[model samples]
Target: MISIENEGKVKHNKSVATKLTPIEYKEITKLVEAGIYLNSSDFVREAIRDKLKAIKVVKIRDVDYEIAKKEVLGYYRSHLEAYISEVAEDLELDLELVIKITNELKKERRLDEV
Candidate 1:
């Protein structure tokens, strides 16, 4: 178990065990010694967060793409300027896909180039 302190409150998190290859263990240890991470748990937590972000973009369908495009357009209409990265993060979409949609809008003259 690990105790995390947030906003003057302490929260306890359960510990999970997993097996790693010798090389992987060595690498993690070396990184910790180099101060890349606080410890193995910190590294694992960061890895898990990165994996979750990657997993968020899977098997997007055409309908989903259309919906995202409409959302992007609506957001642009409301905002004075369209920031592609902000739009992607706000909509929880892949940045590349958002850029593609923005480019399409520019090509169609639906959105002005900024």
Candidate 2:
């Protein structure tokens, strides 16, 4: 078991056996030797954390999509204009997902591009 902390929140992780290629193992060992990571486990944990951050999983359903679309339109109504990135950050949505919703709204003549 491993205990990891992020943003003052503690997460407990279970140990799992993972196989690494020779080159991958060597690279991790080199990093560990250079003090970049405390150990191989630390290196692996950090890599997993980075990958998790890079990938976002959103379960999109018609109901959820409709709700998000309404929220986007509501935001545009209050603000004259907003960047896709800004809307995504403010609404706590994935950037690509927000872009998709915005594009659909534009096509439907509900939103205008400025």
Candidate 3:
């Protein structure tokens, strides 16, 4: 059984034990000696909290990226013909390239009625 001291009270927790290298142990000891943490356990607990928070942020960012990607793709898929026509008119585009794309869209039945 593992115990964590919370507000002067020790609470038993189902914790897994792991061994750290001598160097890692020394670093935690150094942190405590420097008064950075009350003890190695508190440092480990805070480190775990920080790591979990970082993972949560990354997951949220990935979800946001996926949502943004879907919205952009959907917009392009629904407005491809109009966007192509507008681009060809509004920009100095290569005639050959434009013709090739227009032909491809025609084959795909995506070109608007001229």
For model 1, give the 10-residue run with minimal summed lDDT. Answer: 54-63
After TM-score superposition, the amount by which residue 89's alpha carbon in candidate 1 deviates from its true location, in angstroms, is 0.6
Runs of candidate 3 exceeding 4 Å displacement: 1-12, 57-114
Query: TM-score of each candidate?
Result: 0.46, 0.58, 0.41
Better of 1 and 3 by lDDT: 1
lDDT of 2 by residue, 58-107 (tens): 54333477788888889888987999877877777777878999999999
Q: What would the TM-score be for candidate 3 when compared with the true structure?
A: 0.41
Tell me the lDDT of model 3 at 35. 100
Off by over 4 Å in 1: 1-63
After superposition, which runs of candidate 2 have C-alpha atoms over 4 Å from their true positions?
A: 1-12, 64-72, 83-111
Among these predictions, the greatest TM-score belongs to: 2
Per-residue alpha-carbon lDDT of model 1 for 1-114, expressed as tens digits? 657687877787777899999999999999999999999989999999899988854443334889989988988888868578878777777778899999999899999987
> Each prediction's Cα RMSD?
6.1, 5.7, 14.0
Compute the lDDT for candidate 3. 0.60
Q: Can you list the residue pairs that collide in candidate 2? A: none
